[model samples]
Target: MVGVAVLAAALLLRYAALEAGVFPLDCAGAAADGIGGLCAAKWLLVQSFLHQRLGWLSFVLGLAAFATRRRGLAWAGWGSGIAGLVLYSFDPAAIGALLSLLVLARAASQRRRGEEQPGEEPRDGLGVGGLG
Candidate 1:
C-alpha cells in the first residue's frame, strides 16, 4: 500500500519536475542552480527507480521478500518491479515481479510454524507433509 502511494507520488513528481519544462532532461545543471529539491526528486525517480541499469532496488526487495516471507516486502517488490518495467528497467524487474508473486502465494498457502502442535500428525494424513 505504501509502495503504491510512493509510486503515485513519483508519477506526480515526474510530471511536475521533469515533464513540466522545469529540467528539460538535464538534471545536473538544475542542481548547480538554486532550485534542486524537486529536481532531486526527479533524478531519484528517474535514475534510481525507473531508469537504473540493473533495477537493484526491486531485485533486492524481491529477494528479501522471497527469503523472509513478509507480505509487505512482497508488495514493495511488486511495485518496484512494475516501476522498473514500465519505465525501462526490464529484465531484472521481471525477476523481481516473479519473486513477489511467489512470496505472496507462499504466504497465503503455508501454515504458520507457531500453530503446529509439535508432534501432531499431518492433517492430510499421508504420513508427514502429505508426501506418502
Candidate 2:
C-alpha cells in the first residue's frame, strides 16, 4: 500500500520535473540574470543529463518495483531510486520509492529464508549448551 503510493509519487515528480525543466536553471541565478540568463545555459548543460534522463529511468524502475513483488526487481528499483534521489534533492519522491523497494526486498528475503528451512525452528537469544 505505502509502496504503491510512493512509486506513484515518484513517477509524478519525475514527469513534472522533466516537463518543467526544473533542474536547468538555478533559481537564484535566474533571478539575478532575468529572462536571458546565462546561468540557465550553464546549469542546463551541467544538470540536464541526470535530471532528464536518469530521473525518468529512476521513475520507471520505481513504478515497476511497485507493480512487482520480486526481490531482484525491488533491488533494481531501489538502486535507481537512490540514484535519482541523490541527483535530485528538490524532490523526495525518489526517497519514498527507495524505501518501498527496501521493504519489499527485506520481505522477500525473509520469505525465501523461511521457505528454505520450513521445518526448523527459529533460534532464540539463548546460546547452545548441549554437549556431545
Candidate 3:
C-alpha cells in the first residue's frame, strides 16, 4: 500500500537524516548557510515524523476505516500504526492498529458470508437484469 511505502521511506530517511546525520538537522539556516540539495525539505519532514504526528495520523485512518468499512483505509491505518510505534508514537498507534485489524476481520467475515456492500446490487441472478 502507498501508506506502507511512505512509512518505510520515512524510516529509511530517519536513519539517514537523523540517526546517520547525512544531512544537517538544522536546515532552517540552510539558505543562510548555503546548504544545498533539499536539506531544508528533508528537515521539515523529519520534524513532522517526530512528536507523535504519525500516531495521530494512524488513529484517524483507523477511525475512517471504521466509519467507511473500506479495506484500503484499514490497511493504511494498520501499517502506519505499526510504523508509528517504531517511530516513537506508541499508545495511539497500537490502538489504531487493533481497530484496523478488527475492521478487516469483520470485512473478511462478511465476504465469507456473501454479504453485499452497502448500496450495491446483488448479481447472483436475483436483481437488475437477472444476472444468472
Candidate 4:
C-alpha cells in the first residue's frame, strides 16, 4: 500500500531530520547565552520532531487497520491519519489507505451477502467474464 509506504517514508524522514543537524542537541553551556535559551530551542526542536513521528505512526496504523477491514480500525485510522496529515503534506498514501478501506469493507459486506457489484459481468467456468 501506498499509504504504508508513505507513512514509512515519513517515519524515516523524521529520524533522519533529527539526526541530520536539523536541531542542536548540545546546549550544555546555553545558559550563558540567556537562561538556557539554547536548551529551550533544542527542547522545542526535539518535541516537534517527536510529534511529527507520532503523526507518521498514526498514518501507518490507520492503513493497516483499513487493510483488515475492521470498522473500529477504519474509524480510528481515518480520524488519526487525517489529523496527522494536517501538519504534513497531503500524501497520496493516506488517501489510498482511506479509499482502500472503504472498498474492502464494501467488498466484504457484499461477499457476506453473496451479492455482486453493479455493472460487473458474471464470471464463467473458465474464470472469465463475458468472454467466448
Candidate 5:
C-alpha cells in the first residue's frame, strides 16, 4: 500500500521531469544568472543520462527481487533509489527506493514470522542445529 504509493509518486516525478525538459544545461554564468539556470541545465543533462541508465537498471533489479523473492536484490534496488535521491531528491527514483525498501522490510518481517517459503531458510542463524 504505502510502497505502491511511493513508487507511483516516484514514477510521476521522474516522468514529469522528463516531460518538463528541466535537465542538461550549461553551467557557465549559472551562478551569476538567477536560479543557476545554466548550471541546473547542465546538471539536468547529466542527471538525465544517469536517470535513463540507472532508472532501467533499478527497475530490472527491483522487479527481479520482487519476482524471485531475493531480499538482497531488493536492497540493491534501495541503494539505487538512494543514488537517485542524491541525483534528484524529489524524483520518482526516491519513491521507487522507498517502495523497494518497504517490500524488503515486509519480506524480512514475514520471514521472521516463520512464513518463509519451503526450503528457504532464514539467514539470521537463529535455528542452526549445532548451536547450544
Candidate 6:
C-alpha cells in the first residue's frame, strides 16, 4: 500500500541521515579545513536537510491518501510520522496533534462511508414503531 511505502521510504531516509547529527565535524586538527573535510561536512548537512524535507513530504502525502479512504495508510502515516518527529524531537506536542488529527479524520471517513462491521447488523432510521 502507498501508506506503507511512504512510511518505509521516510524511515530509510531518516536512517540514512542519522549519521549527520547535530555537529557533523569529526575531524581533528587543520585537516578539517581542507577540501575533503569541507566536502564531507557539506554532504552530511545536505543529506540531513533533505531528509527532513522528504520526511515531511511523506507525512503530507500519507494524510492525502487517508483523505481518499485509505484507513491503513492514515494509521501508518500518523504512526511513522509521529515516531520520526519524536525521534528528531522538534516539539514534543506535535505528536499529540498528529494523533488527534488522525483519529478525527479516520472516524469521519468511516462515518461518511457508512460501513458496517462484520457480524453487525445495519441500522435503520425507522424504529420498531414504524413511524416513518
- After the best TM-score superposition of candidate 1, give how far the Cα of residue 74 lies from its true spot, in angstroms: 0.9
- Model 6 alpha-carbon drift over 4 Å, by segment: 1-51, 89-132
Task: Extract clashing residue pairs from model 4.
Answer: none
Q: Which portions of model 2 miss their true places by more than 4 Å?
A: 1-51, 89-96, 99-132
Candidate 6: what lDDT?
Answer: 0.51
Q: What is the lDDT of residue 43 in candidate 1?
A: 65
Against the true structure, candidate 3 reaches a TM-score of 0.63
Off by over 4 Å in 5: 1-51, 89-92, 116-132
Whole-structure CA lDDT of model 5: 0.61
Count of clashes in candidate 6 = 0
- Candidate 2 overall lDDT versus native: 0.54
Please report the candidate that would top TM-score against the real structure.
Answer: 3
- Minimum summed lDDT over a 10-residue window in model 3 is located at 122-131
The residue-by-residue lDDT of candidate 3 on 1-132, one tens digit each, is 555686777678667656776775555663567656677666556565677888888898998998898899999898888777767789888788888878999888778877765876556425557535
Better of 1 and 2 by TM-score: 1
Query: How high is each candidate's TM-score?
Result: 0.59, 0.38, 0.63, 0.38, 0.44, 0.35
Q: What TM-score does structure 6 among the candidates reach?
A: 0.35
Q: Which lDDT tens digits does candidate 1 get at residues 26-84?
A: 55664456646656656655666544643667788889999997899888888887767
Best by lDDT: 3
- Residue-pair clashes, model 1: 0
Pairs that collide, model 5: 10-92, 23-44, 24-41, 24-44, 24-45, 25-41, 25-42
lDDT per residue (tens digit) for residues 1-132 in model 4: 645665565565456654566555566665456635546755654554354653555556556666675656665555445544543534533663465468556756777867765775546323775535
lDDT of 3: 0.77
lDDT of 2 by residue, 1-132 (tens): 544555566566456564456555445644555634545554553463444554565556656666665555566556555545544632543643575466586676777756544564444213554455
Give the range of the ten consecutive residues with the poorest summed lDDT in model 2: 120-129
Sort the candidates on TM-score, descending order.
3, 1, 5, 4, 2, 6
Q: Which ranges of candidate 1 are over 4 A from the true structure?
A: 1-38, 49-54, 110-132
